[model samples]
Structures are given as C-alpha cells and as structure tokens.
Target: MKIAVIDAQGAGLGKTVIKKIRKEIGLNIHITALGTNPTATSNMLKAGANHGLTGENSICNFCNTNSLDSIIGPIGIICSGGIKGEITSSISQSVFNLNCTKYIIPMQKHGIYIPGTINLKIKNIIEEIVSDIKKNIEKLS
Candidate 1:
C-alpha cells in the first residue's frame, strides 16, 4: 500500500513515525515523505521513506495526482497556516480533500486538544496508526 507522511518544521515527529512504520510494518508498504521543507523531507527519507517531496507546491501537486491509500501526520497538516505557517491553505485543502484515510496525531503543541487523547503517548498513537495500516493492507490483499 502507498502511504504519505506529512510534516513541517524540524520533522522530528515525521522521522520517528517513519522509523516506527518501517520497523513495525516492514518494507512491504510504500512510504512517501511529504515535507514543508527540504530538511524535513530529507530527515524522513533517512528514516526509511521510499520516496519524498518538499515544499507547498510539490506536495499539493503530488497529492492531487497520486492515489494514496492513506496519509499520516500531525493534525496541523489539515489546518491552514498550521505548523507555524509552514502549512499553507492550498496544502491543507489538498490533503483534506484527498480521497484517502488520514491518521492525524493530536499534539497539544498545536494548541488543539482532543479530550480523550490528551494523555495518550505519541508512541502508543503511532503504534495504533501502524496497526491500522496493517489491517488496511490486509483487507486490500
């Protein structure tokens, strides 16, 4: 299955998620790192994403044309001007309108809170995301 992991800023979260997905989900899944900047994309690529793209236009264009099975990233990805303005309205709109399942990580740092998820650890959240991806892959197969 093809999955895109989007991130901005330093991309530490994206890198960690990619590493966990690679280790837990194995190499069968195709991972695309969609970063707001080159550094973020490069870091996620180093973490084992099969491919990567950087910047707003590249991300928007790719998402528009590609058939992604899923998209995983911080909640900010769907919010215009999220990630300290790294996420543009076009990027948010493209990702939000994509015909694919999206796994959004709720980070309090983003200033948005989901009550039930407030105390959940990022590791646990990623595990859940990976597990769900595995299930989706199984269903497709």
Candidate 2:
C-alpha cells in the first residue's frame, strides 16, 4: 500500500511514526513521507520511508493524482491554519477530502482539542496507529 505520512515543522512526529512503521511492518509496505518543508521530509525519509516529498504543492499534487490506501497524520494537519501557515488551505482541503481511510493522531494543541482523546500519551497513540496499520497491511497487495 502507498501510505502517506504528512507532517511539518520539526517533523519529529513523522520521523517517529516512520521509524515505527518500518521496524514493525517491514519492507512489504511502501511509506511516503509528505512534509510541508524540506527538513521535515528529509527527516522522515531518513527514518526509512520509501519515498518523500516536500512542500504544499507536493502534498496537494499527490492528493490530487494518487490513489492511496491510507493517509496517516496528526490531526493538526487537517486544520487549515496549522503549522504556522505552512500547511495551506488547498493542502488541508485535499487531505480532508481524500477518498481513502485516514488515520489521525488525536491530540490537544494550538487551542484545539480532539474530543475523547484527553490524557492520551503520544507513544501510546503511536503504538495504536502501528497496530492498526499492521492489521491492514495484508490488504495492500
């Protein structure tokens, strides 16, 4: 499956998510790291993603042309004005409208609170994401 992981800024979250996905899911899956900046994309690629793209254009273009099995990212990504405005309206809207399943990391930040996700640790949330991806990997091929 082609799984896109979107992140911006430091991309520490994307790196961690990619690392876990690589180690846990192995080579059978192809991961695409889509970052708002080059640094974020570089970091995620270093974490073992099969491919990486940088910028809002890349994100929007991919969303427009690709048929993905799943898109995984922080909830912040779907917010139109997130990541200090690096994530544009087009990017947010495209991702928000993707026909594929979306696996979002629920969290409270930037005055936004994901309902029912209070007190959930980031590590625990990541583990759950990996588990969910693993369960769905069999359908990839």
Model 1 over residues 17-130: C-alpha lDDT tens digits?
A: 999988988999999999999999999999999999999999999999999999999999989999999999999999999999999999996678888987899999999999
- lDDT string for model 2 (13-118, tens) is 8999989888888888888999999999999999998999889888999999999988888887888888777778999998998999898887576567867789
How well does candidate 1 match the true structure, expressed as C-alpha RMSD?
A: 0.8
Deviation (Å) of 116 in candidate 2: 2.4
Root-mean-square deviation of every model: 0.8, 1.3
| Cα misplacement distance, residue 57 of candidate 1 (Å) | 0.6
Each model's lDDT comes to 0.94, 0.87
Lowest lDDT 10-mer window, candidate 1? 109-118
The lDDT of model 1 is 0.94
